[model samples]
Target: MLTHFERSLVEALRPLPDHRLTAIVEVARLSPPERREVFDKFGNAGYPILYQEHFANLRDIGPWLFCSGKYTSLQGQYNFHHGLSKATGDTPISWLTSALEPSRLARHLGEAATASGPDGSTHLLRFYNEQAFPILHSRQDLPGIDHLLVPIHSWWLRDAELDRDDGEKGWRRYEGKDRADCCGVPPIHLDQACWDALTGDGSSQRLADLLGSLPGAPAIESYYPNWLAQVRSLLAKGRRLGLKQQADLDEFVLFLSLHANPLRGSAKLEAAFNAAFKDAVDGNQPLAQALKQRLPPRLLTSQSNV
Candidate 1:
């Protein structure tokens, strides 16, 4: 059950402005401390209800599939960061299993496969399945994500209650004008900013300030201390917390809380770019060489940091 504080946080965190997508995209690309702060603030604790509902639905798909998205345009930003691409068939699943045995495979793929719509455009499907997941999960490794797909539909829905016959598909066959708003692009990492904003390099001071004034603020006051402490502990230890520990922790916060508008920012975009390039090069993944050629400066920057 959600505590009163959690409920309050959820209420405050909702209704994010679409323009914040630029800030989120910018921060998600940066490094640790920065990335962690971003995740903790925007993506983790401050995520909207649509995302929480979306993730809850994915749980029904079992441990292998993890779904995430937002109602706002931020979804588009996520798509760009994660590189919208498709990987049909078993190739994606096979790669996932091979990456780590099912037991070791802690990552779940988010699918947003959309179908073609009227006017030759695509209509984002309101629903998707395991088969469609792998195709879209290949992008945005910074969020420790695998793939994503947008399922499209032909019809639409204007309201929840429709006057349809019992034998036909419920609300699935509405005309173009009646079609409901279909699910669009799924956000790559919903919790990255929340995590960073909470625990990244210079975040503690801000968190402290927010905590003091959080009485009627978002849910940040409710779980900020405990959550921030745990993250700080992890960062202090700096042990092998896994490849994308910050991203994982951020996701955890979003999964557990119901904050309406905790915090959001775009301070880690460069770091995301760095991590993506490194993953491609060091891991020798599919797009490493090509990415290397495109972002030669990122490679040079990494070497300089060392």
Candidate 2:
């Protein structure tokens, strides 16, 4: 029953890990009726196999999600922008129908009633029997699929914005509006820089350039000591922060240690930080002294202060 493309996709996905392959298989096996059930319930309007391919490709190569243009509708509009905005809202009566029906609603209402305490039982039962069950029973069966595909929508890519012309026509459309009067400022509306970076031609190449520059440009070695110095300076000034701030700083340090150095793991970084703090507190040395002792000497020596 598989088409050539579908067969090829399955072959391609076969070599992936068991979990990924299972996901692909589950998506691909969705019968037409099953897919229709999903569309009717969720307003998602894509072939399951297409979504499966998108997911598989995204897993293998990170940027495939953006490049696939699966986000684009048949009309060339962004699917989320055009399609999702047009989706009908569920009626209030549908809620009650779903509650009384032998569907996801009954389970949900039961959970809500339990969470609400003894007084909620009557109200919840009334809502379910009168509202949810009838609407749910009237509809066809829902999909058994584990995951739902939700498209990312943006206003910048809306048909109106993309169709804009320059000069005379554009000026006439804007007439009395100043730069401040508009929702967005200046010539190209929206965050032009970020928009171009995301949706522009050769977006994949731009992403590649970004990834390639990460390791060499910032020079992680240089960044680590400066971060440590800021923490040391704060400690030296006897300025205490709230628990959340302290936890955030601790997490930031762990992130820097894990990512900045290819050889280090969370456990190694944790040990280093633990040893440094122990030395600082027990020996009456400054936090900076403990850092210098535990961290790479080259990084500390080059930084001069902390």
Who wins the TM-score comparison? 2
The C-alpha TM-scores of every prediction are: 0.17, 0.22
Which residue segments of model 2 deviate by more than 4 Å?
1-259, 262-270, 277-287, 301-306
Model 1 misplaced stretches (Cα beyond 4 Å): 1-146, 149-199, 208-215, 218-306
Query: How accurate locally is residue 165 in candidate 2, as Cα lDDT from 0 to 100?
Result: 36
Please list all clashing residue pairs in model 2, or write none if there are none: 95-132, 96-131, 96-132, 96-133, 97-131, 97-132, 97-133, 97-134, 98-132, 98-133
Model 1 poorest 10 in a row by lDDT:
88-97
The per-model lDDT (C-alpha) reads 0.28, 0.26
Local error of candidate 1 at 98, Å?
24
Against the hidden true structure, what lDDT does model 1 obtain? 0.28
Q: What is the lDDT of residue 216 in candidate 2?
A: 46
Question: How do the residues 84-186 of candidate 1 rate in per-residue lDDT, one tens digit apiece?
Answer: 1121111111111011111111221123323332233443332222222211222223231223211111111111122234422112121111111222234
